[model samples]
Target: MDSQKRLARTAGMYYLIVAVLGAFAHIVRAQVYVPGDAAASADNVVAKASLVNHSFVADLVQATFLVFVVMTLYRLLHHAGKNVARAMVIFVVIAVAIICLNMIHQLGALLVATDPAYAAAFGVQGSEALVLLLLDLQHFGYLVAQIFFGLWLFPLGLLAIRSGMFPRLLARLLMVASAGYLLDVLLQFLTPELADAVNPVLVTLFSVAEGSMLFYLLIRGVRTLRPAEQAVLAA
Candidate 1:
């Protein structure tokens, strides 16, 4: 395969890995997590320990794959705009760091939910409460990461626009998705009631936005530029 084709396949594989594992983890989490019900959430975790373990493992592996996705995307786009590519890497790296660090909270919650010692120390009720608290930390920390998640998209979208290898609509949609992400996080933090009402719509839009680009990369690879365009990209 040529460089573009090789890079596309690598990125496509990583994207697939991240998406599949991420969806799996999220589905498991949603199945077990009872919003605003600490006792119920804890009970669910304890009852479905194996499933929760799967979720955690999937999340960790997905995150690891995402590092490759970012690196590959950087290599693909850096020729179009170096500074923008660097910004994209920086934002994604920050987001990844936050995500990896936040997993400890999830792990802590799991330990508290499963260990008899924790119950002995804090009592069953207190232990459950602690588990809930830790889980909440993980959730909110995810929101914090979303800030960088949105930031990375801006530069990525800009690069896509300049590269002339992607559809202009794709670039526009990415920027729109970035706004959606920032808006979702802001409302979720500042006006949670409103966020609850509207977040699903925003999430769907964001998914579609990213999904479009993902499918394009997988199916089309990067467009082969003409000599003039290549010169511009190199410059």
Candidate 2:
């Protein structure tokens, strides 16, 4: 297939995979965790998670999907007639780098758990004394990337909103998603734990935004980002 057709095929699926991952991570866990009197005990949480079968393949799939999704979004921006290729490229590069760093940090933390004796001999630990100190370079990278992503979404939302090319509903949704991300950033400083506890909600809002935008971009081919409007959204 030609590049355009290939791009068209991928445009919609990327956001859907994001939603699926969210459901698996949140909804599935919620089901397994139960609630109230019948809730799984703290001890049982690990056991129940274990029963679900920890598959490295799942992680690989998610990582691969995100990479492709980034690539697809780059192309989608091109299709939107916005001169955003360089910005999108930078976004993808940072995203991949941070995610890779996160995977490594997670692995390092795991090694400490599975081999405490060996880890101690090697001077490794599952967790450091301070949570802030414990945050690896990747965690910080992820946070910075999220801020960038939120910033990026504003231009995207404005493009959708002004162009009249997309459904106003989807455009509104994207704006809302952009707001949710900014909210996450603000909430992070005031209360990290609370922000994290409600992270799924924030992410869900973002997904609704991206999912709506991606769907319209695919089916309707909205080319709304006029030269002036692009700058406003880009801001």
| Number of the top-ranking candidate, with lDDT as the measure | 1
Tens-digit per-residue lDDT, 1-235, candidate 2:
2454456457557655754653464443343333232213222333443432232234435556766766765664554546554465565556555555554433442333344464366443212321112223434545665665665566555554544446677767766776787778777768888998989998788877786666665665544446776666555
For residue 143, what is the lDDT in candidate 2?
67
Candidate with the greatest TM-score versus the true structure: 1
Worst 10 residues of 1 by lDDT: 1-10
Model 2 per-residue lDDT at 181: 79
Model 2, TM vs. native = 0.61
lDDT of 1: 0.87
Tally clashing residue pairs in candidate 1: 0
Q: How do the residues 100-180 of candidate 1 rate in per-residue lDDT, one tens digit apiece?
A: 899898788889999999999999899988988988888898999999988888888898899887888999999999999
- After superposition, the stretches of candidate 2 with alpha carbons farther than 4 Å from their true spots are 1-6, 22-60, 79-81, 119-141, 159-165, 193-204, 214-235
